[model samples]
Target: MREDAESLDIRDVTANWVNAAVLDAQIKERIKSLADLAHTPLFFGRLDYLHDVGAEQAEGAEGESFYIGRRHVHDAQGDPMVIDWRAPVSQPFYQASRKNPLDVRLRRRFGYTSGELTAYEDERLSDPAEAADGEHTSRLLQAEIERPRVGPMRDIVATIQPEQDEIVRSELGGTVCVQGGPGTGKTAVGLHRVAYLLYAHRERLARTGTLVIGPNASFLHYIEQVLPALGELEVKQATVESLVTSDAVPVRGTDPAPTAVVKGDARMAEVLRRALRSHVSPPAEPLMVVRGSRRWRVPAYELEEMVRELLDRDIRYGAARDALPQRIAHAVLVRMEQAGEAPDDRVQDAVARNPAVKAAVKAVWPPVDPAKLVLRLLSDARFLAEHAEGLLTADEQQAVLWAKPPRSVKSAAWSAADAVLIDEANDLVSRTHSLGHVVLDEAQDLSPMQYRAVGRRCSTGSATVLGDLAQGTTPWATTSWEQALLHLGKPEALVEELTAGFRVPREVIAYASRLLPSIAPGLAEVRSVRESPGSLSVREVTTDTGTLAGPVGAADGGTGAHGGTTADAAAAAAGDAAVLDACRQALKHEGSTGLIAADARVPALAAALGAAGMPYLSPGEETTAESRLTLVPASLAKGLEYDYVVLDEPSAIVAGEPDERTGLRRLYVALTRAVSGLAVLHTTPLPAALAGAPTA
Candidate 1:
């Protein structure tokens, strides 16, 4: 059981601290109050969401609000309101990059601060006809208003505390930092602020005039639905990678410049092939098409998913589902990524999402079979045997090595994205740092130097960085507060921190705070200082793969062939059979249990007991992360949280940058993933990193 959880035995409300019924009653009351206020609030103004509460506009579209206008805003005193900063002159969000603002928008989201908004007075944008937007709202009325089909702009609204919002709004400088932990609802609230700012400044930029840069392809699709649900439409959305070269991979100097395009329609075609059948418009869910084109006959609504389907499937060919639509559809954009592709944004995201297509294209072109080449190198122990020298001449070795990208990078949707979201902000970019607006969802994991690297991307010393800095789990490159503040390069006024957490219980704030490490003046005391109601405990599970004695449990007893336990027992059984003896001492859970492991994968003979399965927000699958028997590789599980982690690798390895230490920081990254308990499963003795797992 989680120490912070109010109860462990209850099935319905597994996340709350109290009983399900009791919690539901309280939630119902709260939601009812919100719903009622939504229906007939005394004030008619749309909720003007601050980045937190204090002052300025948030950068992303998700944070933009439905603006009723200056005449509509009311001071706390209930008098007509006005912003004084813009009196003499205003700045515009649109700067040098006007030809393709969406392109620039991608940069801004990732950390590109150069694209400053040239703010303007409100009157300049108010002249459009009401009917031009196809919606009618009387500016004079004080009554609540419902936007075009978009129902409620925001429902599950997680935002920074009021004070933090003030800090974010108040300053606009070269650099800013938001350091916090995972599950803090940083992404959710940041998006809300985007929508809020846009809506509030509707006169400044209409839906068509604005753009929102998001993390990656799947991340965009995962949360993209939020804004449209609130009645907003036509805002441009994309990723930094996509925006830069239209999601095209730039080969520094290629003889024939093989395939410059990695995203867009050509890419979308590959994605669609992988997804659903060729059925476009299902009039029943009719928002996808403004009008169908002669070249394509199927329903337009199917277009986005078509791209998603095709790409997801294609990438799995050593590639990787959208369901009940919310009646909202991704707007069709003309293609601009590939040479022959039209101006279609939807296609851009699709192609970027499917890396398999690019790899396949590269694989097939020039007619060389990677399998053959790989086989040849891998054949007589040349590839498999690490120490064998003179496997081939230096040039030949270089040719074989230069074949393609890492499978992980190829499979990622970053290529076609317009912005980048580094969920584990502290992780590296080596190449990704170039993408604009690198929004680090979890600011807490980052060290000061990483902050500066990300901050520099802004060109304006601006990037959307968020993390709690509580867990000193990993070493940060930046050492002093003076260094952090100096490296950030922005006035202290511009920095912001979010204190509200939508994920953890109020009780959890206390214990989780201990995770943050020491920081310079920048984050000296931004630990988990908030009070919380959650509890904590750790459990130890040990099983020796070599000493199992008999065939009671198979060599690799995991669920692939033995996935027959009830949800609860399957998790426990997996943990029991997989953890290391010494490491077993570290876990302490109260109820259902949270088993933290070096990684999510189970060990040999420790299959049924390992907590494996990557629980992340893939498009249309945010809630799909249930506790399953997943063979998670420790390297990939870094910075994530799970109830249980089965570190089942018989002999987990960590190589340095050159040697096969796996990804350099991967081992450490995986170790810090657990929020509650941790377990290590192995056949032999333990590794050095986990020497402390031994229990009483």
Candidate 2:
């Protein structure tokens, strides 16, 4: 493939320099995409049919054998060596079964070790002997799911389940919302859906563009390589903050919880609309245009009628303003025709640019700077109260008002929520550019207004929303996917629930599910398919004076600390020592290990790890073979995973939140990050919800 791309004669094929440059660039991109990755397999599965398939299904050839891979690969003779997984012929590889083989006689899955083929498993779907044997489970599939990781996330193209394939292959015209639990592969599904959409509608998406929105920078960094690994390189990734705010208006301050909630309400969108509309006023004087010694006068009442008509139409603020001048000039043209003078489009355009007409349009519909408009709405109390009269209550309005407003947009300390407000105002003034498709991951944490900001970007396209209701830790976390979809302007989108777990072990997810009733009462518990003995352990560490006394089992009654604290400072040191011990024990295993703790407890744990001479990396830092330990704050641990995890003080994690329910949700996220084993070490007693679960 690389040789074919390099051998292209760009200069000979193109007649002009512009076409030559475009062809050269295309050739370069083709060559880059064909580069072989050392440790990534070109193909992972094979399918054999009972008869020759149709030419359309086989991509211009009738074939019975197809090797399914990440991308299409063809030989010099133009015969396919491997079929793209997104192709129609490869659909049966993921969707085929014994009862409905989709005409497949045999299915083969290949296992690779460091990119070299090591083993192959075959399933004879058409044989009656295999049909009577009962359902088959692929050990190779389970092994691939249980494989350890040492860096950013990898694509799951080789392990996509049937249910996931349905969502991935859904049509591009409609939206999809995956209400999945932890380890349900929601993020992976959303990403693969994007890859599939790109493959299915390459030319359309190339012109319209696509994007992936994550919860935070760390989460985005962790999943940055997944798309590229799947042979997709044009998908853009960003956080909500990055999407709304630019370098010109960097976020430098934070709002109080109550203030942020009020600012992020959907009601605020209306308030901004009212505030921007307040800039338009009735014209106080007539518009008079002098064209070639002929003076035309437009009455003030007629001009006011034109302004009211434009406002009633509810077009964009900028668009209406631009149209006002032309509307006035059209009135002047009517007088010209009535006066028996011949006029054309040139005369009307000249009248529209006349100083008198421009001034009247300015007086009636002045230009509005989105940033300056938002600055006034926040800074001027009288202005805000007037627009927020029917929308916000007295107290809610008071909560969102800045205590000390800045003099200008450049000087204001903009919070993340405030940036969202500015974005809304900007959209009101001018329509936002729309993408072809957008994937919003970890969406439970977004507020209603943030959803609107994202919705606008895909207003003309579709979206894939992925989130777990049980993992919502924000003050304004979404209560239901329906409400969230409504805010996203895709209320009719299909909502699919994924309950089967593939990443987290059975024991670990079972233990984490105990908190579901407390955190998310309406949601179903995640049922993991993979089980490993000794995967969950809860140790109660005893703190005696300044020294650590040792660990007791979860069932044992060990009175050491309550409410995540000790009676003295020395006892706290003993708890830290016990956490350190857990980390050491986790490091003894394979793959990466994470030490997750409450946001407030990060400093103490960092000092302990440093004093003990144990090197560790922060969250989002790529894990290495020599350094596989990452110290993750509970706040940022929602989307990350590790082979083994040593969690500190669950009570502290709960106490760090603004309220108990949100705190428990945060704790729920920290509990499900382990892929292999979880050792929760705490001096305080476990929450009542988790105390009854079985432990190692």
Instruction: Please name the candidate that would achieve the greatest lDDT relative to the true structure.
Output: 2
Per-residue lDDT value at 309 in model 1: 58
Q: Candidate 1: where are CA atoms >4 Å away?
A: 1-160, 167-176, 205-218, 229-463, 467-493, 498-502, 505-534, 543-620, 623-696
Global Cα lDDT for candidate 1? 0.33
Predictions in order: lDDT:
0.33, 0.88
lDDT of 2 at 71: 90
TM-score of each: 0.37, 0.96
Model 2: weakest 10-residue lDDT segment is 549-558
lDDT for each residue of candidate 1 in 341-449, tens digit (9 for 90 to 100): 4655555455333443333223222222222322233133334233223233443333323244434322323321111112111111112233222344434433443
